[model samples]
Target chain A: MKLVIAVVQDKDSNRLLNALVEKDFRATKLASTGGFLKAGNTTFLIGVEDAKIPHLLEIIKQNCESRDQLVAPVSPLGGSADSYVPYPVEVQVGGATVFVLPVEQFVQY
Target chain B: MKLVIAVVQDKDSNRLLNALVEKDFRATKLASTGGFLKAGNTTFLIGVEDAKIPHLLEIIKQNCESRDQLVAPVSPLGGSADSYVPYPVEVQVGGATVFVLPVEQFVQY
Candidate 1:
């Protein structure tokens, strides 16, 4: 068995969940924030047999799409606080960052 | 790379985070809940090199420990509501559920 950890934007979370549900795949949702963006996102913990991975990835791919977002850049370290002008830069925000991990054991009571 | 995913009780989260930071290991906190108990918990995503796995696990082991918790059991399915008597059952609540997953790729932008 493998555990698929998909970190997706919050806007795509609901849609992704619905898609997974329709395919009979169960998921555990975790509220997370991106390390770079510091924006809210959803991390899904999905356990599946080895064979179903491709199908699961397809579902995630179809649901989440990358989109441009404007974000203020962080001030440079050791730079004067008053002189720094934060500019809103456009960057891709929406899309799923996925990781597939091998599960040593899974137990439920 | 290995991503150490640890699901721990909310009570032990701060302590665990502090311990990881002291060791210079960065972690991302995710708000999660247990499947069976449906109680709030904290899931940490810690990305580390292959050699540091043992140390990370040790820190988690030392910080989180199992504890007895009294919880009301869920009513039986299809059972009549009027006849059911809710009883508080003692169950082990604390401790970390850890998963170590291999990362195919790691990126930061």
Candidate 2:
């Protein structure tokens, strides 16, 4: 079995969850913060058979849409204070960052 | 090398984190909910070398202690309503549920 770890924006979480549920997929939702943006996101732990991976990815892609977000970039460390600019920059966000891992075993009680 | 995904109770999270930090292990903390108990829990994503798996497990075991919890059992589904009785049951909870998965690649920006 493959364990699909999907990190998605909070705005698209509900819809993704609904779609997964509708497709008879069981997922564990985790609230996470992005490392770069430090913004709240939802991470889903989905265990599925290997053959169903494409289907799952399609579901995620259909649910999550990339969107533009304005965020102020963090200043570089050890940089001159006068060189720093704190202007909001438009960045593309809101698409799922997914990782597929091989599970050695799975047990439930 | 392995990615240890540990699902632990919230009560043990801080202590576990401290222990990991002291040991110089970097981990990602995620807020999660348990499937069976429907209770809030913490899921830690710890990336470590193969040789350190045992040590990491030791740290998790030391920090997370199993405890008895009073939980209301859900009534049987599709059964007679009169036959169902709800009672608070003493259940063992709070030990880490760990999943060791193989990582194909690791990337950071």
Candidate 3:
């Protein structure tokens, strides 16, 4: 058994989850903040057979496609201050890594 | 000097993010699977001052309200094989714990 951990952006989470459900795979979600942009993100923990790692990774890849997001500089008011500029950033916000850890035991009741 | 971690249902994530943005606070979201039903969830990590902890908790409480979600037993095939029941579970999918860690160094560049 292996543990698959993936961190994804908030936008693509629902679709990614529904797809996982359709595949009958179960995962645990954890809330974690980012060190760079300090934006909200979702982390998924999945337990699967080692043989299925590639297949599961494909699913994650298909779900975590990158896109452009408009981010404004941090300011007290709505970037309404003198430094307010709606800059379009092509953020590669997708699956950071799939941590596959060997599980010593697996049981469900 | 605290690390507040919150795990919330996926359904309520967008609204929560918006609210946090409105409050001018940034959080990190992680995607993780669950131990119970193996469902999808969104986790948020926020670093805040002790005095702001209560205020942040209130936002989470207001958003992470209990709700019913239908889950089926895991099977190679859908529960449609033999049994299928749309069960209602009042899952308390909210902030599990807040880990406040004292940061030895804090810097922003």
Candidate 4:
């Protein structure tokens, strides 16, 4: 079995969880936020047989979506601290950060 | 930096996140349920320096608690489906399932 960790935005978690459950794909959810945006997101810890990874990824890709978000640039005006106008730059968020790890052992009790 | 994944019980998640934030450690939370009991739990995706793993673990250990929960046994009776009488058994839950992974690359934007 492989341990699939998918980090998705909060807007997509519920729907993704529902889709996984519908397909008998059980997973655990954790509430998380983005490092750069500090926006709320969800991470799923899914345990699955190695053969089913492609299907799982398809499901995740369908549910977890990416969109643009407006935010102030961190380094406004070319690193000028003083006399700076913070423009709301558009940044893309909501994509999934996925990690697939080989499971040494899986126990259900 | 290392990616520390901690699967903790729902009851202890808030406290643990608070503790981590108090210490200036940032993490992402995922809402997840347990495998055996199908109970609600939280998974944390913490990004930390390699040198701070022990300290992160200490924080998780202190905040994520373990306790017994009553659940129905999967196989109520041995090789008998009709004459099965389900009995609730006490099982342990609410401990952290931690995985520390070596990060290949780290970026913030």
Task: Give the best candidate by DockQ.
Answer: 2
Per-residue lDDT tens digits for candidate 1, residues A57-109, read 88887787577788888876898888776887887766766777877898889
Model 1 Cα shift for residue B99 (angstroms): 5.5
Which candidate's TM-score is highest? 2
- Expressed as tens digits, the lDDT of each residue in A31-101 for candidate 3 is 66774223577777676778888889888889976655555445447444665545644455555455665
What's the lDDT for candidate 1? Answer: 0.79
**Candidate 3 residue lDDT tens string, B1-109:** 5555555667777888888888877788766456324235666677676677667776776776554545544553544655643454343343332233344555669
- DockQ metric for all predictions: 0.20, 0.27, 0.13, 0.15
Q: Kindly list the per-residue Cα lDDT of model 1 for residues B1-109, writing each as its tens digit.
A: 7888798888888898889888988677886767522467888888788999999999998998777878886887798888676888888866888988787545331
Model 3 docking grade: incorrect
**After superposition, which runs of candidate 3 have C-alpha atoms over 4 Å from their true positions?**
A36-38, A69-91, B1-109
Query: What DockQ would candidate 1 receive versus the native complex?
Result: 0.20
Q: Interface RMSDs of all predictions?
A: 4.1, 3.5, 10.1, 5.0
What is the Cα-based lDDT of residue A55 in candidate 2? Answer: 97
State which docking tier applies to candidate 2. Answer: acceptable
**Model 2 interface RMSD, in angstroms?**
3.5
C-alpha local distance difference test of each model: 0.79, 0.80, 0.63, 0.76
By lDDT, rank the candidates, best first.
2, 1, 4, 3
